[model samples]
Target: MNQNHLTTLLAVLDEGSFEGAADALRITPSAVSQRIKALESDMGRVLIRRTSPVAATDAGEILAQAARRMALLQAETDVALERSISRVPLSVAINADSLATWFQSVFSDVAKWKHATLQLRIEDEAHSLTLLRRGDCLGAVTTEATPVSGCDVRELGTMRYRPVATPALKDAFTSDEGIDWADMPVLRYGPNDAIQESDWRGRLPERPRERRVSQIPSSEAFLEAVRCGLGWAYVADLQSDPLLETGELVLLDSTHVDVPLYWQHWRLQSAMLQDLTQSVVDAAKQHLS
Candidate 1:
């Protein structure tokens, strides 16, 4: 019933596990469990199904939506009241790839401040706009060419990706030209992350795998998997550069995934949103190469 309970429930639903949810929310799993129990008791129904990967029951789905709405409202209220400072909390919905590649510069620039807090939601670019529509986020970095209704848009930059692999994987590929790198365990983004994948296919003479070898949802994990030398993957150039320099990775070819990024924010009169957008835009120009 309380906002804390709603936040905890939302965390559990977003993370899909008690431990992950607890880690994200900065609370113990026992506390998360208690919050969910209290919420279920108030709602008079079992909300989330207790399973390996947690799933929302029909009722839980309703609560999940409601919780997101409430979190937005409360966070906005807090932001509004604490607006005396030059910096304010900025909640942004962003695709994993951007967070992995370019947005880190923006985040790092803001981290030095005492008053700027960012609540980030990891989502697909294809769907990040929905969070803006629901008022759950003030800004989003998205791939959509058109701005969401009732929002302002600014081009942050474009991200380029290339097919890459470890030296061992590359050697293996070279050893047998008959071997399909596509069939090789290629780390991929969750769904529809193939903008880069398509580029890789065109760059290659032929594809061996009908589908990706592995699908990783998180940016950090995807890059880690590739670094661990478990598989080849399409990596954003901005993100791949450091790994390449460290000799931990190498590019397979010049083929690239070029995804244009746009910064979208509510068209309302929120100074914090405006400042955050400008900060990101400035950061992009410096680091999105």
Candidate 2:
């Protein structure tokens, strides 16, 4: 396996275009194309789909991950030899709620990552594992306990979300039969978000299809919207603390949903990754439910 070609392939995947990768590497675009072609020939498979911005084929994704692990080892070796080291940014995927709540705590120690740059890709907790499977990120905070192929898994902790709304809205919706959620405005983070919907199904006898829905995509904004009586939302316990304390938000129901979080990473022996994994685990222990 040619390391240079593998590195070029990963660069193209990361940058999403040949010219973009060339600009980052300070090489000519023509040179970048040649390297990719050589790599495809060596592997006897097409590696990139030349779209508006390039995308990797399945084989390309596998090779790109291999390149990442190889680069991590090489950087470690160079540091050990007292050679000048070029830091490759470590890309990770995480859910928005985690990022909004406790994700920053992982980076509090600068001494632990002086040689690395951490890049975070945010998605919903249920969908974060897709980024890992596509090799777009090396590690992810996800709801998936099952490890992706060629990866290791660890339990971080559960994130509990309570059904909450403004005090007036909670009062208006409550009845002898419980909250009248069928006609209430429901806050959804995005189109794919099913947390609110799931909570509805578990508490009520029907689905949330007939309810009025608002798309408040930003996590912080979502909380604010719920607090302002725009609608009911399942707010993370950590994020709802201050609002609950100030009586700005009121629980619609005592029933809460617990989403179990797991850390998934490549099965590599790099010290940098090991340190990062431990930092994340420790932070989750201290902060999460």
Candidate 3:
């Protein structure tokens, strides 16, 4: 089978439709279909599910991943052969908090090179590894310490969060001894957010049966909501320190939650990957616990 077929399959999966892939690859939709059909015929299996937004079959996923790996290796090979000075794109997944806080510092020096492009896919720290598992990115910043298959995991550092609220909220709770914590409005990033509840559980004797959570998905917006006294939340210590000092936000407890982070990347023998990994580790050590 032609290697180009695998590349076509990847394009189709990335774009989510035949026409979209055609547009991206600068090929006609008919050509795209022909390549896919030929690839599937060569594999002797149905590789794609033929959905409106096309999805890969289990077999297709394997081939797609191989295609991605090959592309990366080929790019590196080209760089070495031609001694290319052009920027090479590297796609990575990272959590919003890291992006908001310390991620940029990791690439500060590299950014000046102007020969390294990063395509960042932001997800929660706890979930970023799913992108690596799906073969969507070459590297990820995640809370999971365990390495994914064919990947290496290195501890970055610990990030700390503390439960905080406005001074007014503290006054309200003090006046009501029978106050149900659940009824009090809580701030959360999304449904998957466990920081608020987890902190609550550790501080209080019992878990709240129900929580009146206000969802603010954006990390910046979530911090702003907390600053504006919309609701109490577990804000990153690094982010909330200034507010806490100024008495804009009050720490409800002295207890701190530490989330250990890790960097996971494909176990490829590539100099560029090694340089990036070292840069991340050095920056993380400077910023995190």
Cα lDDT tens digits for candidate 1, 40-91: 9999999889998898787877676566545545555665677554335477
lDDT of each: 0.76, 0.85, 0.83
* TM match of model 1 to true structure: 0.66
* Candidate 2 Cα misplacement greater than 4 A, ranges: 83-85, 110-112, 174-178, 202-210
lDDT of each residue in 205-281, candidate 3, tens digit only: 87566756789988888899998878888888878998999999998767778888999998988777788888888
TM-score against native, each model: 0.66, 0.91, 0.90
The true-versus-predicted C-alpha distance at residue 101 of model 2, in Å, is 1.7
Question: Whole-model lDDT for model 1 versus the true structure?
Answer: 0.76
Compared with the true structure, what per-residue lDDT tens digits does model 2 show for residues 1-289?
A: 8887887888888788999999988999999999999989999999999997999988988887778878878887776676755674677899888988877788775346556778899898889888898877879999999999999999999999988899898888788987787877789999778787676677679675666889998988998899899999999999998899999998876788899999999898878788888888988999987
Worst 10 residues of 3 by lDDT: 174-183
Return the clash pairs for model 2, or none: none
In model 3, how large is the Cα lDDT of residue 139?
A: 92
* Segments of candidate 1 deviating more than 4 angstroms: 1-89, 108-116, 175-179, 196-212
Best by lDDT: 2
